[model samples]
Target: MDEVITAADASITGSKSSIIPYNLPLLSAFLSCALAQFLKLFTTWYKEKRWESRRMLSSGGMPSSHSSTVTALAVAIGFQDGTGGSTFAIAVVLACVVMYDATGVRLHAGRQAELLNQIVCELPPEHPVSSVRPLRDSLGHTPLQVFAGAVLGCIVAYLMSSS
Candidate 1:
């Protein structure tokens, strides 16, 4: 009886050890976001003619980090669990929703912010509202930016999964 119990304990421990140490989908998503954010730095430098490290931490850039993250997660799930699986289906749905939000609602909000900032700039200096900080005008990405992010995410996930 003791021998049987000891063998069972060893088997459980061995099985635990054999389990994957990292969640591949999650890692792929995070890495995709990080890469997108990092790339923003270079894009900003190119367009502004000056390096701006803050772009790495800011939202709404040349490539949408939100799109990259969701796309990467979906692609990773598809690669690991098969495109026909329910998990992959869910990931696809989520990615679509996120991409839509980035290009639709958030894009509109960014435009509104720009307009509001312009209005604020015209206000008198002594106006109480004029003393407030300007709204952020880069809260979302263009359609092209979203597409670029999605492509980058897919590439990243594919490379990670293939290896």
Candidate 2:
């Protein structure tokens, strides 16, 4: 009876140890976002020498928050499921779509916004208000941005799973 009880307990504990919860993916996503934002704050502070100064929340900066978030999700999914598994494959495809959108579609839009802003600035103050529009110049992830995001995501996911 004692041996049976001990074996049952060991089996239960082993099952628990092997089971990874679903929240890990969400946590990875949140951490990536947080890390990117914190990096932005740190970079701003370093550049301006003021902890209180806030740079405009940019879309395309070092480490690319969008890339970070999605890649982190993918990495976490991969950890929960093997890389060749269906869940991991889906996550990878989704991440690719998001990264492409960030670097391609949104980037061109930002450039267009910059051009329109310049055109508006050259206009007279008395010109119609319709001529004025805010410019969004930070919209594309550089190679470095994507790379940093991938590295950050992989490291975070691995650590989260291991812990």
Best by TM-score: 1
- Any idea what lDDT model 1 has? 0.92
Per-residue lDDT of 37-125 in model 2, one digit per residue for the tens? 67866665776666742343656666778788889899999888779888889889998998888778877887888888878888888
CA lDDT scores, all candidates in order: 0.92, 0.77
- Which whole-number lDDT from 0 to 100 does residue 11 have in model 1? 71
Give the least accurate 10-residue stretch of model 2, judged by summed lDDT: 52-61
Best by lDDT: 1
Alpha-carbon deviation at 41 in model 2, angstroms: 1.4
Model 1: per-residue Cα lDDT over 30-137, one tens digit each: 999999999999998888999999999999988899999999999999989889999999999999999999999999999999999999999999999998898998
Clashes of 2: 0
Off by over 4 Å in 2: 1-22, 45-58, 129-131
